[model samples]
Target chain A: MPCPYLEYRDTSADQSFDEARAFCTVVEEFVQPMRADICNDRYALDHESHCEIYRAHAEGEE
Target chain B: MSYEAFLDGDPVIVTAALTGGVHGKEANPNVPETPEEIGRAAGEVEAAGASVVHLHARRPNGERSFDTERFQEIDDAVRRHTDDVVIQHSTGGTGAPDADRHRPLRTDPPPEMASLDMGPLNRYDHLTSENTRGLVDSLHAEMVDRGIKPELEVFNDGHRNEVHGLLARRDLADPVYATLIFGPGTLTRPRPEHFLTAIADLPDGATFNTLGFGRHQLPFATMGILFGGHVRVGLEDNVYYERGELAESNAQLVERVVRVAEELGRPVATTDEAREILGL
Candidate 1:
């Protein structure tokens, strides 16, 4: 599943991935697809999550 | 990627090439010539949304210098003013001894990145930047030793082919980053189709940065964002804010590009994101 905080607007003429730039709410920063690709969208998985901020946020909730 | 499975594109990484060696205050008085000036400009550009600062050291008299000490001083000044912007040094030059080209990478804490010209290109009627295969290999080897990522400078299609040649001979770090430059002289022609062709020609998994000289800067930068690649701006590539007026500051140029990216629905990459994208 895509990260919950990953917000994007796809407006490409053909609706391709060309125009989709993602932003992460947890860190309040724009992120590359590489980071967004593996994020769990819910609770962060300790070894699998590429985002430190999302992991910390999930830990705080727990 | 085809939308059978769609994937988000990378955020735009805005790089500010603060001051170029070819021109100085004479071209634009706002071009920073001293360590303090460059540092202050670095901070401003970072605030305006650039995640990387491309640096060129200058002598006290405003001439370009490849001295390691000068690079060190500039790096020190940059750190004093900004928090996390990546620092990239320019190693491409004309008429300099082949050995002196290595000076920029020898600073105490060498730049996190350095430009590596893929091949030779003509500068003026009488001069040529002889970035022969041997020099290119030597520079790439040093960057590898220092853990500095080489931002391959692709001036034309020949240089693009050289990128393939370099990759065939030696292994570069993952996600090979190259800057596709457009302009007169030895640079690729400034046209949308040419830029698209360059993008199409890039080896798989390599990320490209868009740079257009002078009047081509803004339009190409917008296209870069639309195409989901990074961008570079500032007085180094352009001295004007518009056709006739000189740019007030490097920050102004960065600010304009940031605005364009936002309007196009693309978020600007933060410094951390830039590091992640570039593997720096």
Candidate 2:
């Protein structure tokens, strides 16, 4: 998917960090600073992790 | 954290509503009213842990005032004591029939931030506080025009919707700052579920602080920090610091919030950080 912050048209789907870097290299030439500032902090991330675990448990039961 | 960056992280901003308009000298002898007393009380609270001081002005006779002179006096006095603490003035005057509640904003030099009630709410089981939509729009416009950030006061789910609508209409800015007021016999009951549900409905880029009425202050305040929000505490919301014991000063309440934040492992936001977070 296209990056929400960037206005690129030939963007591909979301992928792992290495895959994303390779795709960016193929599509264009840019080296943007990777800042995790936009990412949620440890608390919110931990909450999300718990939610994923609960979802997996529910899926397994089904 | 960068100012804007920290808000996205939901840093807790504790505001001490030092002297609310509800109680007079008869209710709590230590409640500050005069300029000197109010300023001194605010200074102590800021020192304790509060980044912001919510102010309500009164004459020597202990009557609330929306008049500019009274507000200026209190503002000047607070400035005299401390320049780092944020000063927020209340728009809710005495629960009077004909009193102009918005008179403080009408003052020549308005407050840096003003309280804007989103909707009407019942107070304590006797008084009906009026907060019409037209009043909200007008007040919001004035505050935006005057470069004053409004502390949106939400008492229920409907009030939350109103705030959302205001933002959708571009009447308010991003990172919408609000105060979720919880009290008995009001629109919102003071409970964990009430807080959780209210917060769940908050829009993206929005931040809120919580305050409970009467004795429920500490519980809801504690929850506010744990739930990734801010806290507001003072005699204005509750006169008693503990069960059956009247609070001696606003500083005592501020000190309590400080302790609670420390216990919860949440760092208190400074005035400058709060201004940047709230876009004040």
DockQ of all models, two decimals each:
0.01, 0.01
- What DockQ was computed for model 1? 0.01
Task: Write candidate 1's Cα lDDT for B1-280 as tens digits.
Answer: 1111112544789999999777766567688878999999999999999999999987764556788999999999999999989999999766567788999999988899999998888753434678999999999999999999999999999988999999999999988999999999889999999998998898888888999999999999988888878899999999999999999999999999999988877788999999998998
TM-score of chain B of each: 0.97, 0.91
Q: Give per-model TM-scores.
A: 0.80, 0.76
In candidate 2, which residue pairs get closer than 3 Å at backbone N, Cα or C atoms, i.e. clash?
Answer: A1-A12, A1-A13
Clash pairs, candidate 1, are A3-A41
Clashes of each: 1, 2
Model 1 chain A scores worst on lDDT over the 10 consecutive residues at A39-48
**Candidates' interface RMSDs, in order?**
22.1, 26.0
Cα lDDT, model 2, residue B55: 89
Q: What TM-score does candidate 1 reach?
A: 0.80
Residues B1-280 of candidate 2 have per-residue lDDT tens digits of 1224333445578898877765555466677778998899888888887889898876554545567788888888998888688878888632432236666776556677899888877643223566877777777787788777899899877899988877876567667888988876655877788888898788876788888888889998888877788889988878898998999888898888888887667778888888887887
In candidate 1, which residue ranges exceed 4 Å CA deviation?
A1-62, B1-9
- In the range A1-62, model 2's lDDT, one tens digit per residue, is 22222222222353222112212223332211111111111111221132232234446769
Q: C-alpha displacement of B240 in model 1, angstroms?
A: 0.5
